[model samples]
Target: MRKILTLILMGVAVFSAGYFFDKYEKNTCRAGVAYSIGNVDQKFNVSEEQLIEVASKSESMWEKAVGRDMFHYDPKAKLAVNLIFDDRQQSAINETKSREKIAALEQSYEGSFKKHESLTDQYKEQAKLYDELLSAYNESLNSYNSLVNYWNNNGGAPDDIYNDLEQKKASLSGQFDNLEIKRNDLNSLAARVNDLGKQLANITSTHNSNVDHYNVQFSAPKRFDQGDFSQNTINIYQFSDINDLTLVMAHEMGHAFGLEHITSSASVMNALMEGQDRSNLAITADDLNAVKIKCGYK
Candidate 1:
């Protein structure tokens, strides 16, 4: 009986150890505390505390999904938007600000410059063709004139021969007229190039000014990761040009937690927000499933 009881106890101990190890291996991203990277821009509407608050809200989504804490607030964190406001812009734009005006102006100037560049090669080819046609027309005119003089000087020349020269002159004159009209069209296109150049310069100046304004309006967190898990930090930048500040914050936190952008518009991890279905600012079912697959549940 003693021998049988000893074996049973040993088997239970071994089973318990195996279960602990398996659970430990599966649990991920629970090691270190994350710190908030403080605000740099004083004028930013969202305070550092508020940034933390939003991040906490984002964390709740992931935590609920994984049944584990993915992030925590530490005073120290790394820093890591706006639209004419470039998509690259990180600071959030005020909702009251005119996104339409900025977007339209940016579109007009950027589109104009791109169109101008495309036309350069086309215009060069057209101008070269015009020159070639002009040369051919001049040659034909000179040749016709010489033939007419010859007929005038030599009145005995056949009437049929004179008729042929006149016909040739008329044909060349018609071609020259058509070529001149095409050349005038090209000239009009050339004038637009100069006008677009000025507009491009003006747009460039305006874009720089808007960028500078955003720089002053918001601040981003600093990022620091040096191989050590404890040292890994994601300082969330509080200011953004997008109205969905919480969504952006969640996206950044996702990066810190080794999550990637998803193609589904339903996910907060989408690469683009434009035309995306951002009905929920939290991690979707798919997103949670992916995280669980990667990080496992508690």
Candidate 2:
């Protein structure tokens, strides 16, 4: 299978190199210089200075991986994100304010619980007083009503209206007391729950949707022997791929470019990965176009 695929890429490269010899005049990409062969919305050459910037970052990343107590692994299903680690950007945006707001709400609820406890205690204390006052008021109100009825039945008494009004006042006083008790009970539970906190938020809001590329070392050098719109995209296999190095880098770069894995074998953006899918290490037209679109190409 490998030999057959190699023959195909070499033949195509020979034909394309012979045809558009002008574009191949100067090669800027070096060993492991990552490139994408997709429908990239934006395409530009990285300056020599920028290339240096990219390459200088590898040393520190490799160091961290070596320093690990143990390589962290997911036991159930192992899938690690690829990246030669980059410098940690600490000056990124912070979300502590939002977390603080959430914590404030939690504190409010905790206070409510405390208030409920206090209210319960108060309610108990006032219950005895309320019962005594309410019972007395009711008994007085009943007596006053009886007197008014007797007065009305017998004849109009001098203090009939005044005494009746006093009985109604006493009844209202008891109602007021009951209302205060109920209000305290409801107020204690009026506050609500909120967010506890966001203590370990490493990624900030600006980078929320940023494309994360993993450290992808190709199984072999990648190359695209043919020329097309996709071929405009470049991948460096140090100019060597026992197989199609461009295709492999382009395909994997499609993943780094943040395109989802898909089913098209003819695509650079195929969901299939090495040791994971059925295909030679190469990018297809679909993979190129998908990335071009994501890169904001028209």
Candidate 3:
């Protein structure tokens, strides 16, 4: 009888322990994951406060979509979200800077090209006017000389005829002065056009050199696993900006929520970052369904 009672007590104790343990686990899981900003490398240049703000926004994306809390922010939480600065992030930054330099060079080149075009047009118009004026001046000079020669051959001219010849000479002199002014203007335009051409050539050379250097430096395609959730921690490897960071954080948080990759490319739980609208980062129907299924939501 004593032996049977001991076995019964042992069985009750085991069952009680197992029941409480299961209940505790269920309650803990219902409470959701607690996370906080962990080690933020100084090289990332982001303060802890800023990271916390970003983390809150990331948390809200999941909670708002599922209509329940999926993550809680606790400063002492073991689930640390760390910003680790490494070659992945460095390469992204370098590529961005290089593209910005190329864009600036392109804009400058375009402006210079347009100015050069405008100056060339002005040169053409000024040259055309100068040529026409020279032709007119030469024609008038020939007529005046012919009249003068005729009067000389006749030994003398009537006063009216002499007066007319003087008037023609004065008019020709004025025309010559006008032609001289136009010639100077045309020459100035030509000089400006030449200078712009040299300027444009220099710009082209510099732009090409920069492009060559960029190609040599960053020709190889790079792939990065921007962020990941492992060992009770989320590590952000690379991101272009705050918006990108938010998406990465949300994706990792989805993993922490016990959700696996979904088939929907637009879902935050997608294994690959494709078709996701980074600007308006939010969970999709698939993501919400996964959350509901995982958390046993009605």
TM-score per candidate, in order? 0.44, 0.23, 0.77
Best by lDDT: 3
In every candidate, how many clashes are there?
17, 24, 0
Candidate 3: where is the Cα deviation over 4 Å? 1-29, 152-174, 194-224
lDDT of 3 by residue, 87-119 (tens): 988987997898898899889889988998998
Whole-model lDDT for model 2 versus the true structure?
Answer: 0.40
Q: Kindly report which residue stretches of model 2 are placed more than 4 angstroms away from their true locations once superposed.
A: 1-105, 120-132, 155-298
RMSD of 3: 5.4
lDDT of 2 by residue, 157-212 (tens): 67767676766777767776776775565454333111111111222221232212
Q: How well does candidate 2 score on lDDT at residue 212?
A: 20
Candidate 3: deviation at residue 2, Å?
A: 24
- Expressed as tens digits, the lDDT of each residue in 1-298 for candidate 1 is 9999999999999999999866644543555236564433444555556666766777786777777777777665442211012222322345225444557668988898898897766788889999898898888889888888887898745978968887897899799789989889899878877787788899888877776665565233212110011124443333333235566666666766666667776676666554333355567887787677666553
**TM-score of the candidate numbered 2?**
0.23
- Comparing 1 and 2 by TM-score, which wins? 1
